[model samples]
Target: MRVIAAKEFSDRIRNRWVLAVAAVFAVFALAISYFGGAQQGAVGVQGMEVTIASLVSLVIYLIPLIALMLGFDAVVGERERGSLDLLLSMPLTRFELLLGKFLGLSAALAASTLAGFGLAGAMLVMQWPEGSLWHYAGFMLSALLMGMAFLSMAVAVSVVVADRARASGLAIALWFFFVLVYDLTLLGILVVSEGRLDLDFFPLLLLANPADVFRILNIFSLEEVKTLYGLATVIPEAYTSPWLLAGIMVLWMILPLSLAAWKFK
Candidate 1:
């Protein structure tokens, strides 16, 4: 299993598209820092925080793109290239094979995200920010878990679909829905309903969508800002707790991964 996992990881790392993704992320982070510094009138911790927030904000879009690119063809790509039968003929069980592929793709994403945050953190630390490195680190960890969830969803889509194009299309559409449209639609619903429904259930309802959980996580983590800056105005009362936000994210991470693995068998 370990060997298979290593091979899968290596295969993904070697892909040119993966390298391109790394470059894009690097560029995006640099741009964030440059613009943030310009706007803030100095290069310091606040600038760094802006950079981190920008990068994290980009995750809603980037994470799904990376996952779709990695897994849209996981099975179909192999099958189209006439490698699936050969792979199945190997001694590895379906579970091991799936795990190997998922771990590899996920590791690639994790490494890139962590590297981006690490570089940003070093810059922030050098600037002597009042914030702890631990806070940014926690945010990075959450981003990674969210990335894993996205990857699992992509893999499941790939496995169930027969055509690579269709699979990719489906993955991207789902990404748009969950990461972008779903939240907007939910807000519209709340507005149309005019708060007539219980506002109390919003947080629990939000758990059904991964992006909402992520946003809540970000908002709750910035407690001082929540209190002083009134940033909590956007957050529903039920999602005010970091623990609850974290739990919701965990559910989002686990449910899709489990369903994907089971469906693969």
Candidate 2:
């Protein structure tokens, strides 16, 4: 597992995938943080809450797509290349191999996210000394967890699908559902129900998607800015705790990967 993990990480580093992703994230983070309020005829570091809110929107759209694209081919590509059998013939279980692949890819994604966002955060902090340091750190961590959860789902798709083409399609479909369609669908339901449905139960539907969990985690942490943010505005009091939402995020990380491992075996 260690050997496989190291090779996977080193391969990403060698191919400059890490650098490319980090550059993309850093560019977007800086751009959003600095120019997000341009429509209001202002430019520069806004308040920490504002900057983080902007970046959260950016991450919700970008990170899951990147993570899914990155790992969608992990297992299927190996199978297509006829290397999966050879690897399985080695002294390792399928689960171990999958674990290594996930860990290595996850590390690459995490490093890129931190480096990119951390750079933007540092710049903002320098400009706005009053910003909450831990708040930005939490935002970055939640972003990383969201990336990992999607990556896990991508790997699961890689294992279940017959080829790379199907994996790619399924991964994108998952992204569209979770990032774009899920909330809209829920809102549609609410509209159709016309307040007849119990509103308090709405937050439960959010747990099914890691992205929604992330929104809740970050938005609620910045309590003062919750109503002013996008995506998730009114989480139930029970679901507002960051730790509980984070635990759900962890479950999101595990369940898909666990399914993949089961299918792989």
Instruction: Please count the clashing residue pairs in each candidate, in the order shown.
Output: 0, 0
Q: Which candidate should be chosen as best, given TM-score against the real structure? A: 2
On residues 65-160, what C-alpha lDDT tens digit does candidate 2 reach at each position?
999998999999999999999999999999999989999999999889999888877887776656478899999999999999999999999999
Clashing pairs in 1: none
lDDT of 1 by residue, 1-265 (tens): 6776677677766765556666676666666666656655775335444555666678667776676677667767787789888888999887777777778778777777777666656665566466657667777777777777777788778788888888889998988888888878878988999988776656566677766666567646665444553536645666557677677667765676677678777
TM-score per model over all chains: 0.86, 0.96
Error of 1 at 215 (Å): 2.0
Error in Å for residue 25 of model 1: 2.4
User: Residue 92 CA error for candidate 1 (Å)?
Assistant: 2.0
RMSD of 1: 2.8
Model 2 bad stretches (over 4 Å): 230-233
The superposed Cα distance between candidate 1 and the true structure at residue 232, in angstroms, equals 2.8
